[model samples]
Target: MINISEIANEKIKEMLAAEETPNLFLRIGVKEGGCSGFSYGMGFDDEQHEDDKVIEYSGLKVVVDSDSLKYLNGLEIDFKESAMGGGFTINNPNASATCGCGSSFRTATEAGNPAADPC
Candidate 1:
């Protein structure tokens, strides 16, 4: 299961409300190639695939593809405020190691494909 913290939920809702496009839902996924071999993808999407798993949180809809479900299971999302600014943060239980930027990770059983570029 995926968890979205209260702060993150509120921030997401605000962003959704500000969007010009309608019927947008949050989409989260894992993709190959990063400093740690795997990278995360999150954005607003209006399209839904046959293999998508939809999860609802306080009237918010989130979609996850079948291929990324395994890597994102038990994932936790949160947002924090700072003097500079605030951004969403991820706490992934499936990740054995994460890159310095915290945008890439590697699981205990899988290393995925690391990119040549630096994080």
Candidate 2:
């Protein structure tokens, strides 16, 4: 399971509303790539697969596929606005190592590639 901070909830609602889709769900997952071996993937989705897990936070709907659930469990998502810009940050307790870019990460037991460099 994951937790969305109030700031993230507000920003996500605004983005979803702009999409103009009445039933859009925020889909988050991990895919192979990046320096850390795994990268985060997030976007608006309209359909949920059979193995997807759905959670309702505030008024936003979130969907995470089973394969990514283990990696994302206990994650806390927050939105922050700084002089530079506004962005979403993920605090993933499950990640043993994360890349400098922040979006890429790896757990001790599940590194994505045999040849991927250590984080």
Candidate 3:
């Protein structure tokens, strides 16, 4: 299961409210090609696929594709604010190793496709 922290939830709600597009929901997924072999993808999407797995948190809809569900199970999302700026943070339990930027990771059994360029 995926978990969204209270702070992240509030931040996501605010962002969603600011969007001009209607019916936008959060979409999270894993993609190949990163410094660590796999990268994470997260954004607002209006489209849904047949193989999507949907979960709701306090009225906010979160969707994950079947292919990425295995890599994102037990994932934790949070938001942190600093003097410079604020951003969302991800904690993935399924990742065996993560890159320095924390946006890329590799699982114990899978290495995906790593990019030659650094993140």
Candidate 4:
């Protein structure tokens, strides 16, 4: 299952409030690209597919597709504020290797094709 920290929950709620759509749901998935072959993707979605898995945390809605769930299951998302700024951080137990920027990762079982050279 995917988990969101208290800090992230608050941040997500704030973000959703700023959106034009009142019923926006946080969607998390993985796509083929980045240095590590797979990159995490998150955005506000108002639509859901038949195979989507939906859950709620701190009253916020989250959805993940079946395919992406394999890579995102047991994922923990947190929010952090520092001198640079504020950002969301993902701690994924299923990732065998992650890129320098921490947005891309590869699993032990499959390393999908990268869009370009490693960054």
What lDDT does the true structure give each of the candidates? 0.91, 0.88, 0.91, 0.89
Per-candidate TM-scores read: 0.92, 0.91, 0.92, 0.91
| Candidate 2 residue-pair clash tally | 0
- For model 4, the stretches where C-alpha displacement exceeds 4 angstroms are 111-119
Among these predictions, the greatest TM-score belongs to 1
By TM-score, the better pick of 1 and 2 is 1
lDDT of 4 by residue, 1-119 (tens): 99899999999999999988877899999998878878999999999999999998979999999999889989999999999999999999998888889999888765444443346
RMSD of 3: 2.3
The per-candidate count of clashes, in order, stands at 0, 0, 0, 0
- Model 3 C-alpha lDDT per residue in residues 10-94, reported as the tens digit of each score: 9999999999999999999999878887899999999999999999998889999999999999999999999989999999999
Flag clash pairs in model 2: none
| Regions more than 4 Å wrong, model 2 | 110-114
Q: Taking the tens digit of each residue's C-alpha lDDT, what string does model 1 give over 1-119?
A: 99999989989999999999999999999998888878999999999999999999998899999999999999999998999999999999999888888898888776444442334
> How many Å off is the CA of 97 in candidate 3?
0.6
- Model 4: residue 14 alpha-carbon error in angstroms: 0.3
lDDT at position 87, candidate 1: 96
Clashing pairs in 3: none
Instruction: Judging by TM-score, tell me the better candidate of 1 and 4.
Output: 1
lDDT value, residue 96 of candidate 4 = 80
